[model samples]
Target: MSKINLKKILTYGLVVFFIVGAVGNLIGPEKILEDYARWGYPNGFHLVTGSFELLAAILIFKSSTRFIGSLLASCIMFSAILTLSYHAEYSHAFIPLIVFMLLLVSIYLHKQKKLL
Candidate 1:
């Protein structure tokens, strides 16, 4: 596939991932609630996370705001990695770490596009 197609696919994938994450957090499933509690976050903290995720998704869906969306995603993933590491959840941290790297790539791609 062309580079443009690859970039578009990646962008769409990230958007969908964030949207799913937002919906899951907003739904506040029992496991998610338990996780927040375990992480020392107060109840309903999921709402805050969900809101941010939703915002990120929206920003990412717009080419003009994609960089900001990636930045927001990077921040969220960084926090997740730190929290998991502090709590000795290395396995859990891996996913966030991967996402963090993906966000970095997204930012790099955005910058490259800006310069071209």
Candidate 2:
């Protein structure tokens, strides 16, 4: 496939992933709430995170805002990694770390003008 196609695939994949995650956060499942409580966050904080996630995912679809979206997503993932690690949830932390790397790649490609 062409480089443009690959970039589109990656961008869309990230968008889907973030959207799913945001929806889950907004839905606030039992386990998710438990995790937040364990992490010392208020119950309502999930909604806040979910809102940001949704906004970032939407921004990522537009060329002009893609960098900011990636940056926000990266920040969110980094925060998740740190919080999970603080709770000794190593396995859980790994997932966010992976997402963080993907966000970094998104940021790089966006800056390199390869993602438009």
Candidate 3:
């Protein structure tokens, strides 16, 4: 068996991330609300976060909006990291932080000056 190409793997990873996360938000923003509650955020924050996640998912699928979407997502994930870190929930939040970093790298690679 051959190793998967890094770029292909990253691309698929991003697609899965956005699609699954968007569906989760669209179907049950309540889960996000629960997470916010765990982090002690106000009730209304879940709606805002869910909305952004949905929009970001759409943007990420489009070539024109990928950069903006990735940038906004970077902000959102970093905020989550900081909030969870403050509450000492690093164990649970670490995966999201790593995913965000991969998203950032994917965005950089996709937008390479010479390529796009």
The Cα local distance difference test for each model comes to 0.93, 0.88, 0.74
lDDT of 1 by residue, 1-116 (tens): 64568778878988998999999999999999999999999989999999999999999899999999999998998999999999999999998898899889999999999999
The residue pairs in collision within model 1 are none
How big is the positional error of residue 20 in model 2, measured in Å on the Cα after superposition?
A: 0.5
Model 3: which ten-residue window has the lowest total lDDT? 22-31
**Candidate 3 local lDDT, 1-116, one digit each (tens):** 99878865775666677667656655666667687788887767665776777777677666677778778777778887888889898897887799889888978977894386
lDDT agreement of model 3 with the native: 0.74
Q: Candidate 1 has what TM-score?
A: 0.95
What TM-score against the true fold does each predicted structure earn?
Answer: 0.95, 0.91, 0.76
Off by over 4 Å in 3: 1-9, 25-32, 113-116
User: By the lDDT metric, which is better: model 1 or model 2?
Assistant: 1
RMSD of every candidate to native, in Å, equals 1.5, 2.3, 3.0
Candidate 1: segments with Cα more than 4 A from true spot: 1-4
Q: What lDDT score is found at residue 99 in candidate 2?
A: 83
